[model samples]
Target: MAAAQGIYTWDSRSSSYSEIYARVRSWWELLPDGSNPLFVLVREFEATGVTAGSFAVLAEQFSRRSGTAQAVRCDLELAKVQEYPAPWDGLHVCTVTVQVVDESNNSRNAYAAPVTVMINCPPAVTAPTGRCAMVGFYATAERIVY
Candidate 1:
């Protein structure tokens, strides 16, 4: 069996953080047997006016045409937090990783249709109302096919 992979990038402006979606390629196949997995990695995350501990990353596999979520939702974990200078002063930069559950038992036709990885930012109780920015944001979806 060989593995098929798709790499998708976030194409919107950094200021738009409400609902960030990465479009997966239509040519990639989604295999059965629970082998298809999507990985989201954010190399640089910044929430202006929000503290490091005041925000969470929520990600889900969704189908826009159907207007339904296809896979289990996950909370991305921040690997590290660091302080920056000048323009980013008082803001914390973080690294995040999200792995969506395997896409299994779904119809091949359903999988063939357009799918997206949607990312959202929800503020914690102590967090102030602010905008979220993601840099180097991308997703990788892989499946093994015979």
Candidate 2:
């Protein structure tokens, strides 16, 4: 599902596919109130600076898919944002944790390797010219420091 959503092009050797698959199944099981796993996958991709064929790949993750895709929802509260000094004097670091969780009350299912996004700011003032780059991304549990 992650590859289908353009969250990433599949890598046969990578463990991300398994992790994402599990997360998707968990979200699907939660059904009614759980956050949309696909939407979150796209957000995770964006956070990681994904490169694909076109915007359509990314756009399809949110809309333009099957009817059931419409039911997918994102939880804004799951993201926690923080600001800190970047390595340079003028640039600042903006970090966001896109936490993935299961609907179950059990804490064990609470966090599934959060998608960490780090952006280097400030964006340019002009349209068509402005861009903020993501300096860091930790896509899965192995990247997380215990």
Q: Identify the candidate with maximal TM-score.
A: 2
Which RMSD values do the candidates have, in order?
18.0, 15.5
Off by over 4 Å in 1: 1-87, 97-99, 106-130, 138-146
lDDT values, one for every candidate:
0.23, 0.32
Give the per-residue lDDT of model 1 (tens digit) for 33-143.
322333223221221111123222211222111222323222222222212221223222222222222221332222221122222223522223464222122222221
List the candidate 2 regions with Cα displacement exceeding 4 Å.
Answer: 1-84, 89-95, 99-111, 123-128, 140-146
Overlapping backbone residue pairs in candidate 1 total: 0
Per-residue alpha-carbon lDDT of model 2 for 1-146, expressed as tens digits? 13213222222223243554453333222212332335554444444333344333433433111111111222232232222223343232222233332221222223322333333334422112354443333455444211
